[model samples]
Target: MVGAFEQALLALMIFVIMLGMGASLTPRDFYLALKRPYGLAIGVVSQYGFMPFIGFLLITFLPLPSAVAVGVLIMSCMPGGTTSNIFTYFSKGNLALSVLMTVTSTVFGVLLIPILLLIYANALDLEIPRENIIATLVLLLVPVAIGMGLRRLNANGGAVTEFMGSLLAVFFIAFILISWVPRNWEFLLTTTPATYVASIALGVCGIAIGYAFARVLRLHPRNARTVALETGIQNGPLAIAIVAFTFSGTEAQSYMAVPALYSLFIVIVATCVTFIFRRANTAAEQKMPDGLL
Candidate 1:
């Protein structure tokens, strides 16, 4: 179980992280992206649709405890992480589309997340505090709104804040390794392999499925890559914040297992995926416009 101090620290970090995500955008950015909504729509499908289903499948097949299962499902169902934008940039994917996808999924998540969790959680006969989670998700948006306000008021400040958020997303992995791993060493040692499998496979499968989904839609390779990254790279910090804020007791630690492990592994997973994407970046693809339909 997470100590009170850890829970408080988690909340504070997430607040700053979300604030950074908000700084990366303005009302104008959304207005521009809305002009071309097709790719944006695909991202939403990938996020709320494909990713959650992926989670459901993992838990269905894996023999996870109820608390651990909850963690996996929640982690899988998250919106595109701002971390995706950083990887998308390095992967030579469409950064604009990536950012738009992140924003759109987050905005829509307020409505879709509870519904999806309710449906899937019921299937597994697990209990979720839907109201608490809903409240947590809504509260998270406050930092984002503040971040957006910062952007609208001053472009330079927004850029800096955006950088900090993305940077923190990376450093958070180290935080987990340092703070969480040591404390949970015994639990990790005794954890079932299925848990680890579920954790790793969630990202791996989401990326593969997302890439395939984009190709089937006949999207441009750059856009396809963007969709794949956006789909696989879920908002880990948000999921962690949700779990930390909504649950208490031994259940809190169990609920945190997948999200914490996923957060640590995703950086490694995305790094490898980004290398492959870089290899696939053809000259023609580079010359092609970054704008997505």
Candidate 2:
């Protein structure tokens, strides 16, 4: 069970993360979405469509406890993490499209997450209360809007907001390392290999399906890569927040494990993906002549 101090810290971390997300955005980002709606549309479809399906299959096949399955499903339902933008950059992807997709998906997530979670929970015969889901979603959107407003009101606020966002990211990692991991050491140690496999499969399949879907839609290579990263790198902190808020005591602790593990696993997978893309990009660049460049 999470203590009062830990619960308060978790809430603060989530707010800061969302604020950073909003700080990163501007009216211009939304305008960009309108101008290149197809990329955004395709990204949203791939994120919501493929990831949830992947989570469902994993939960059905794997022997995850009920709480862990719901946790995984919630993580799958979330928007692309800010981390995906970094991975997209490393992978030589469409950075602009990546940002746009992240912003668009997050905005859409305020509504979609609750709805998708309800649907998946019902299908899986899980009993997550609808009210709790709605409450969590509302809590999430409030801070995001405030951050967006801060940026919109003052041009310079974006820089500060971004800095806060980055700082919050570090704090989140540290909190997990120093607090969550140690507190849940027993569960972590006892975690099944299948749980690890399921988490890995979710990330890998999300990237692959997103890329294939983009290719099928005739998107450019860079755009395809961007979609793949966005689809695979989910908003894990948001998942953690939802679990913490909606459940309590041992239930919260059990549910927290999936997103916690996923948060670490996806980063490693994304790094590998980034390395492969970087090497391929470098080779392609070498093959091209200077004159063409």
Candidate 3:
């Protein structure tokens, strides 16, 4: 009974997030690809290349259970979140690039996440189930495509799209809270010390490494800030749902819960990074030339 409820909750959560993601898109969003392409490149490369490497290193040194290690790697391998775009916009980052990045990463994730997870799991001596991979793709890709279709139908111009977009955001938040509260209440209280420590460590490491990489590459401060936030934060609710549903039919290890733990950690880390960037922006503005100011 508990298992069934968990799966249902996860499915609902994914649908809500995907719908929100789709409703937020505009036709010009796709067209803008030709105008400014580098933003998408930066977003995608940092998301796929940098985050996964950090996860691999964290898993290697963290002393976590094998399932937990796999869970972290899978979460790192997943796409950027709609929330990351919001954060990027608020921080004066490139909103268009963030949106395109999220869209492209999600589309690629249909295949990339499963393949990467399978390879990583195999390296850890974990069994890979082909059926589970298909299930993950179905749950993620189906709603995304449906939501995009709905948006495209009303793409010409309408308040309906905007209304749906706002409602989708509310629905996603509610679903995540609902899905989270039931399953995680106990785990939050009883989780091991190592789990908490590792979650914090991973969160901190992701932000610092991502920020330094972007800085070294000479990305604009705004883009660097966005990349750091996107790299540190993830589509964690989706990840948690995937694990809960995919492992429900089998005796999956309790270590699958680590993604949930990491999800919470990412929120904390993102919040801190946001504040830091805001302060940095203030400092930069104060130093601006009189003409610019």
Please report the candidate that would top lDDT against the real structure.
1
Give Cα-based local distance difference scores for all models. Answer: 0.88, 0.80, 0.66
Q: Across residues 5-47, which tens digit of lDDT does each residue of candidate 3 receive? A: 7667656756766766766666676677545566567666777
Q: Report how far residue 106 has shifted in candidate 3, in Å.
A: 0.9
lDDT of 2 by residue, 1-293 (tens): 46789889989888888888888888887887787767667767877878898999999999988888877888889888788887888898878888888888888887887788888889999877668877887878887888889988886886698668756764676677788888888877887877678778888899988888877876666777788898988887888888888788766877877787788788789999998877767556545442100
- Root-mean-square deviation per candidate: 1.3, 3.2, 4.0
Stretches of candidate 1 off by over 4 Å are: 287-290
Sorted by TM-score (best first), the order is 1, 2, 3
Comparing 1 with 3 on lDDT, the higher-scoring candidate is 1
Residue 227, candidate 3: C-alpha displacement in angstroms:
1.1
Q: List TM-scores for all candidates, in order.
A: 0.97, 0.92, 0.82
Cα lDDT tens digits for candidate 1, 155-219: 99999998898888888778788888899899999988998998899999999999999989878
Candidate 1's C-alpha lDDT? 0.88
